[model samples]
Target: MKIGVYSYFIKNQARIFTALVLTGILSVSSGLTLIKDARAASANLSLETSSDVSKDNTKSNRLPRPVANAVLQDLASREGISTRELKITNYNQQTWSNGCLELPQPDEACTEALVSGWRVVVSNGRENWIYHTDSNGRSLRLASANTPSNQLPTSIKNAVLQAASKRLQQPISQLTIVESQQQTWRNGCLELANPDEFCTQALVPGWRVVVSGRQQTLVYHTNQTGSVVRLNQKPNQSTLTPVTIPVSELPPPLDRDVVFRQISSGGFAGTTYETVLLRNGQLIRVRIGDANDSERSVRRVSVQQVRQFLRSLERYKFTQFRNLSYPAPGGAADYITYTLTSQKNTVQYNDISQNNLPSNLQVVVKAWNQITASAQ
Candidate 1:
């Protein structure tokens, strides 16, 4: 009986041990699951913190409400879209080289002054637009405007717009700048001269501006400045051999640096006067007998100043005067006879009421006077 009791007690002890072991195994498994859940929660918290930090940084980089709205409103107006669709993506302070933000329209004069401004980038997710603005957003300019393939400079496009408006007798608002192609026109008339017109056969760098309006597509050819625009249309029963001024007849030294000399004689004094202009902006004058005329008084101008003068020569089509002689009116022999020489050709003209000088010659005469006065 006592042995039976000992065996039963031993069996009970074994069952208790099993139950404790099972309990320990279940406790370990639950602890491991709790640890995994805690680690996952920690990772989630870390991810949330990182996301919050990124959002904070992005917000910090955002622009002020007014400045942002200014660009957005402008672009929205241009695109005919909602302001909410526009987003300001980036911006920074910049000092522009000139009042035109370093993007001057061809021949559009920009004030030579530094401007403190901001360059803001706006976007519609797929495409981006750039803008330049003063600090307070009082003055703003769109640097990246509408153009698909070949883009004309802003000024050139505006010029074409104006010209097309006049040619079509339509308002500017109805016109659209569609396309541009760089072209080298074969003549001064941009190859659009009338049958009876004569064109200078010089290579003219220009553009073909395409516009769409009133259910009609119009093509216009223009010089770089859009200063010369011609419409392409059906010929008006006109056909003829084109007359051209040969390139050889084109004028001088606006394309290169060279010397220009002028000799004056046959005035009342009958003394010879010679003036020399060097590309370096030096002007020297000499006379045959008069000490005042013979003594060299030099006035030096900047290279840019001289280049501007040369541009005037080109702008006035001074080449037309090449090798041409304009004599004093029949009886005005005492007038000063002036001879101007360039590397390519010589031109002579005299001062007499009856001598009809081409208006452009006055541009050169004015320049000569300015230098000669400083020399005197």
Candidate 2:
């Protein structure tokens, strides 16, 4: 009896399935031979059935086949699992953003914005892994699913927060727990290190807790039992000392003893406005138009507020901002320049956003803007 083409195709598919089942034990060459044979059989079926084979060809061509294969093989080897045990759940071409990397110390070269890359999500039944790769399929990093804080037991959360508070040397009420998540901990080990011996066995499970203080945000890493393993260093508080500035750098036409000149520029083509804060808490606002046309308004700001602004200026080390610049995006940039002067020193810095500014400086800028807007 002659076997029908459909029957032969079904039998061939069963054989390919069995070959896949045995892939864990099969040699790489043997596995490839089986795959090649399966493809040849599929091609033969299309020829006999008069069906369009171009669809099959195009489907195979759409993905970066070699890259995908290499990723599967590498992941399986690292995980000590069969390739068949891993399933590719999702994949897409991605453009790298500023925070695309989640590694402890990401490659500096890969941090460029708008770079082309690929993100592949794979799973092995119980856990999911995400692989980030460059356009050339070079693996940049691997991240696993994080257990959300809400899902964690309340005791675990409390323990972690307590540990964080102890590390920060602050009371629990003073520190705010920003976030917590369960993640695989490498304990600062290399990604390519032996997973079984170093990373997985050494630090299999961990939690990352983030807390915010008055001066900075701190990240803490802890084990499953909520014991602190590591924490990031605090911001450089030693540099917060006061700075002296010369009186000559103040904008002209003001009193010869003016100590601070805050020139703010905004609107299209950069309109100018200025605020002069003297040493005795007196403030003068000047609005300038083209050709040096100007109007001045005067007010006595509270000594407390003046002290706060001065303290912020010193804390943020604004004097260090001289010659620092940020390119403004077209039609959307506003510039703020703070020039502080005393009898012996002068410093000026300009930027478009408060993100680069210290928290105290940010508050000072907001207050200055309010005062300027009122004068307008």
Candidate 3:
């Protein structure tokens, strides 16, 4: 009877241990299943949130109201200008590649892979500032005017006013001095044509006086001795006389029916990248490297956007910037060339700095850069 009882106890104890072990295994499996489900639910929620934000962005065309306000505050702080004085003239949306951050490298060719952002143009009456922001309204860059300003002596200011009044055929009282800044005379003499005995081979210190009248403004340069030397004369004086050129005599008007070809190339290698704007308003960008490698990208733009682009070109007077050149001397110096074509005409310009571009041409180039950066 004692031996039988011991055997029974041992058998029951083994069964109980097996049952506990099985239960623990089941518990661990259930816990793992719960963890997996929780992870999936979290992931789904995150995806839904991201989709909603994208939908909201797609539905909105205008910049968020807060963005403008934030930009105003930031720009005023950086430029030391009053917010009230700054006017937001233009706002544009575009894909902003991080390429510009890589200074001295030709901007990476614009591609669909780049991030989207905004470009805002602001003005403080006398100068314009370009501000770039990411989609989140964070400032990326603020390109403020870099024009230099130097105060003039009271005597020098008076002399400049007198000279400006005579040249503009306006009384001293009618003319108001808008600005006076020091300039280095690059030419040998301050005289418009004939050099005085004081003219030297070395650069001479001078003053630039801007006098404004009700109808027009006159720019004058004065030597250190306060003698008026040169006037900001109109270019191509011979062509100043208004003579009507018959349409038949003029080059055929550009083919406005459709965009033919728009190509822009720039970089250290002379042609590091090329962007082609198509008739359908799509952009095809190609990055040229060594013989073995090249990258390409395509971006689609709206018909309305393309039409507006053509309209913007209307403001450009091809004649004004024609024959003008800003030479870059060194082999590795940066250069940009724009070649635009239509059925009727093809025009091209190359320059080292857009700042040296004519006023109207500068506007055109600015618009082009903004469009290419965003669309490509």
lDDT of 2 by residue, 1-376 (tens): 3568889999999999998878856777788999999999999997866656666766644547655776788666444356998888888777666344433221123354565667888887776767766666654555442212324445555775676677767777766554455667655431223336555445457765556554445665666766445564442332121222233544444354464676666555566777687655677877776456446668776554554554445444343333223223346445655553432234444565345444444565565555445432
List RMSD in Å for every model shown.
19.0, 25.1, 20.2
For each candidate in the order shown, give its overall lDDT on alpha carbons: 0.68, 0.55, 0.59
Candidate 3 CA-lDDT value: 0.59
User: 1 or 3, which is superior by TM-score?
Assistant: 3
Q: List the lowest-lDDT window of 10 residues for candidate 3.
A: 101-110
Instruction: Evaluate model 1: give its lDDT.
Output: 0.68
TM-score of 2: 0.28
| TM-score for each model | 0.32, 0.28, 0.33
Tens digits of per-residue lDDT for model 3, 150-256 = 44555666786787778778888876654455678776565344534555566778886656665666666778767555676642322111112223433333333
Q: Supply the TM-score for candidate 3.
A: 0.33
Best by TM-score: 3
- Candidate 3 residue-wise lDDT at 232: 64
How far in Å is the alpha carbon of 95 misplaced in model 1?
42
- Tens digits of lDDT, candidate 1, 15-39: 9999999999999999999999999
Q: Candidate 1 has which clashing residue pairs, if any?
A: 287-294
